[model samples]
Target: MTQSTIAAPGRAGSRGRSLIGLAAFVILVDVASATASSVTLPQIDGWYAGLEKPWFNPPDWLFGPVWTVLYGMMAVAGWLVWRDRGLAGARGPLLLFGLQLGLNILWSLIFFGMQQPGLAFAEISALWIAVAATMVAFWRVRPLAGWLFVPYLLWVSYAAVLNASVWLLNA
Candidate 1:
């Protein structure tokens, strides 16, 4: 039987707990991506600070709080999908989740670790696409889940322009 139709003794409680875990896992993934990408922070303090950034670029301090909330929302979105059909049931949605998450982490690595603004710009463009795809897929499974990514998509869109500007100015 499907998840909504299932009837069991402790299944509801069990799923409630597991869903929390799943959400936490998604948050952790975001944290890990941030951590790995942080290798570039030092560069930002020195080399990056020397580069010409657009007037509209946000202050560095704003990123931490923004990402924390975004990550939490992302986890909730993923968990909603997982809660619908468990691991196997939400395989397609989860796979899209994984794809976007990987792209997220990869963007940090490419941008900060490699110190290649142009390359990183291209990478973030792909990340934007991946995130959009994930959001669409999640929405297909659960409408609320899809809506959760709205802010994320908007932020990434802004980030893309910032990235492009930085690359051009630096080049």
Candidate 2:
């Protein structure tokens, strides 16, 4: 084989590794956000335990597992879109994703950290719209990537309702 031929496989391998690294980096951001949000879990336990939740309020244990799955899916969805479009190509959708994720982190801080369910409800309302917009943008770029966001959207919808309920109950 010519030198160029020999170099082709090496290049492909490097690209594959780069993509994997990028995916990992995306997942790491989610994990870090989750970890930071979890810092209030202990205090949240005490506060939440005292609250008069609505009849539909889920058990506290359910959130951890549910969010773990959702975050995993979120990272994969964003990574898929990023892989397809790169940063420059997919700037809008990815920006929406980041905004929603930021809102997600903020919700935890507001409800759990600051113990303000009412404000968290308002923030989550915006987050719900941002998630939908991100999903639509992802759909336009890559259908599968958009489909991956379905569960996340559904959960956030449910969470939004829950947040509203909590706000109302405590108000």
Q: Each candidate: what lDDT?
A: 0.79, 0.78
lDDT of 2 by residue, 59-159 (tens): 88888788777787778777777666666667899899888888788888888888898888888889889999999999998898789889999998998
lDDT of 1 at 57: 92
- Model 1 clashing residue pairs (backbone): none
TM of each candidate vs. truth:
0.86, 0.84
Task: After superposing candidate 2 on the true structure, give the runs of residues whose Cα lies further than 4 Å from its correct spot.
Answer: 1-15, 18-22
lDDT of 1 by residue, 46-148 (tens): 8778889999999988987888788888988887777666666678778988888887887777777787888988988888998899899889988999999
**Model 1 ranges with Cα > 4 A deviation:** 1-16, 23-27
Q: Pick the candidate with the highest TM-score.
A: 1
